[model samples]
Target: MESTMNAFPVLETERLILRKVMKTDAASMLTYLSDKDVMEYYGLEPFKTEEEALSEVAWYDEIFTEGTGIRWGITLKGLDKVIGTCGFLNMVKQHSRSQIGYELDKQYWGKGIAREAMEAVLRYGFYEMKLHRIEALIEPPNTASIKLVERNGFMREGLLRDYEFNGKTFDDLYMYSLLRRDYKGELS
Candidate 1:
C-alpha cells in the first residue's frame, strides 16, 4: 500500500511509536543531537543549542512537506518524549527508492531500541511506501549502525570513497541496501 500525502504516517511496533515530529519535540531531539557521541558518525557536528534543535525539527517538516522524505520521532509506547528519530530521505519516487537514517540517545544505545525502531521503518519503506529499494549510507567506522542494518537484512554493497562532505572534510561512506525482493524473501 502506497502512502498518501494527506496524513503524516504514524508507525507502531511492539514497544515504540514512530510519529510525526513536532515543534514540541525539539527539546527531546536536542538530547541526542547535542551529544558528540551520537553525532560522530552522523556527519554533522553536535548541535549546541535548542535553537539548532528547533531548526532541525523545521527541516524535518520541510522534507515531509516537500515530499522528499518523512522523519518520525521515536518514543516509547506509553510516553510522549522522543528518544530518537528515524526515517527515509532523498526519496526518488520514480526510482522507488530512498535512503534511511536514524539515531538514538546515548542513554538508549545498546538496548536494541534502535533495531526495533528500524524494523518498523523498514516495513514502512518497503510495504507502505512501495519502495523498490532502500539504502543506508553509513560511515565505515560506525560498527553499531552497520550491525543494525545488517541485522535488518541490508547488505553492504561497497564503500563510496569521499562521497560526502561532512562540513569540514570529505568522508567515505559504505553503501548498504535491501531490495524489495530480498526484504520479502528474507524478512517476510
Candidate 2:
C-alpha cells in the first residue's frame, strides 16, 4: 500500500467533491446517519445524538492518520455541505486490497451521487494507492448497493456466511470485488 501520510487527498468528480471529514461536518453527518432509512443496511443503529456523529467523524480522521484507511465526506461541486461519505477500510498493504463502504442521505438517494463519488474513490484506490483489488460487502437484501457495485465493474465473488454481527444479530454478506485489471479494462 502506498502511504498517503503526508497530505490527505481530495478527489473531485463532475458533480461531487470528496474531501476530508471535519468537526464542522458533524451536524451534516448526523442528518443522514441518524436517519433510519439510510442506516437500514449500514449495520449500525441510526445515531441518536450529535456526539455519536462526532465520533464517526473522529473515526474518519483516525483511519487516515493511522494509515489504515481513508474516508471522504461527499459534497456537491459548489456546496460545502456533506451529503454523504465513502471510502476504503480494512486495507491490507501486504495483500494490496481494501474494502469499500459508503452511505448517502435519504434525500440524495437516486441522484447517482454515491456512484459519482465511488468512481473517484475507485480511481484513487487503484491508481494512487496502487491497490490490486477493492472489495465491497453488502447485505444480501441491499439490492440497491448490489446494483451499484455491478455497474461499477465489480464482480460478485461469493457469500460470506454470517460474516458480520451487527450488535444484536449475525448477518450474511455478499462479497463483491473489482480488480485492477478489470478496472483498467473498463476504461478501455
Candidate 3:
C-alpha cells in the first residue's frame, strides 16, 4: 500500500480537529474501540488488545494515501490526546459514495461530540472529496446513533435485512444518506 498523506489531510472544525490516526493514538484509542458498548452496533467483536487497535489504525494509514478512504482521529482543539475515531470507510470512488462510521469513548457520549465530528466528516466528504453521497448504516437497536444521523440531515433510506458483520448475521441495518442536493439546502 502507498502512503495516503496527500489524499487525506487533517481537517479542522470549530472545537475539534479530525486528523489522521497515528501510532501514538493506539493506546488511547483502544480504550474506546475495545469497549463492549461501543462495539454493540459495530459488526466486529470488541478489540481485546492495543495491537488489534494499532492494526486497524495502520490500515487507515495506508488508506489515507491511496485516496480510497478517509479515517480520522477525532481530537479536541487544545489537546493532542485522542478521544475517538471517526471517518469514512469502504470508499467506492467510481460510485462516488462511501460508508461513514464513528465511535467515541463512553464519557464523550451525549455531549454532542459525535454530532460535531460527523458534521465535519460530512463537509470533508461532500465539499472536499466531491462525493455524490455519504451514508451511515446502523443497527436498528442503536437508537442514539440512529438519532444522531437523522439530526445531521441524512435521510433514513430504508432497512437492509441481514447485513453481515464478523461472520455473524445481522437482522437489519437502517440506511441513511445525504446527497449533494440535500446538503446544498441543509448545510447553510
Candidate 4:
C-alpha cells in the first residue's frame, strides 16, 4: 500500500516513480530545493538542512489531509532518488482547476526529467482528480522552465505583471494552461 502526499493516487512514468514524500527524502530533496539557480524563479529560498526539507515534506502532506490539492516527489525508478517535486496549489474545487508548480535539481533539468514529471502530474490531475484545467506561472527570465511548460502542451495565456517575488525584487510571469480537452488533443 502506498501513502500519498495527497492520498490521491500514485503514478509512474518511464523514468520516474511519482509517490508520496517521506521524511526520509529530506537529504535528497535538499539537494534540489537548496540550490539558488533551481529556486530562483520558483519563489523559494534554498533549504540548508534535512530538517528544513523534512518540514517542507510535512507541510506538503497537509494538502492531502486538508482535501485541497495533491503533490508528488519525483524519484528515479532504478536509483529511487528524489530529484524534484511537482504539484497543484491553490485549488478551487468548484472551478475544477488549479495552479501547478515544479522544480528539479539543476542536474536533472536537461535530461527530460521535468517533462516526464509534468506529464505524470497532469494525468493525475485530469484523470484521478477530475480537474478540467491545470496551469503554471513562470517567471520571465527562466527560459528553461518556459520551454519545459511548452513541451508539455500548456499554452501561454498572457503575462501577469509583477506576479511574484524572489525575496528582493518582483518578477513578471507568463501564464500557461492546458485544459483536459487540450491534453487529449480535442482543443486547438
**lDDT tens per residue, model 3, 1-188:** 12243545687878898887888899998998889998887787899999998898889876666667778899998998789878887888878898898888898899999998888888877876777888899888999998988888889989888866555664588889988788843242
lDDT score, candidate 1, position 144 = 95
RMSD of each: 1.8, 1.6, 2.8, 3.7
CA deviation > 4 Å runs, candidate 2: 184-188
Candidate with top TM-score is 2
Predicted candidate 2 versus true structure: per-residue lDDT over 76-140, tens digit per residue: 98999999999999998889999999999999999999998899899888878889999999999
Greater TM-score among 2 and 3 belongs to 2
Best by lDDT: 2
Comparing 1 and 3 on lDDT, the stronger one: 1
Model 4 poorest 10 in a row by lDDT: 1-10
Q: Is candidate 1 or candidate 3 better by TM-score?
A: 1
Give Cα distance to truth, residue 83, candidate 3, Å: 1.0
The sequence of per-residue lDDT tens digits that candidate 4 reaches over residues 1-188 is: 11233234667888789888888888999888889888788687788888889888988888767666667888889887788888887787878888998888898768988888888888778877778898899887788988988888899999999878768888888999998888853211
Q: In model 4, which regions exceed 4 Å deviation? A: 1-8, 185-188
Clashing pairs in 3: 3-65, 4-64, 4-65
**Between prediction 1 and prediction 4, which has the larger lDDT?**
1
Ordered from best to worst lDDT, the candidate numbers read 2, 1, 3, 4
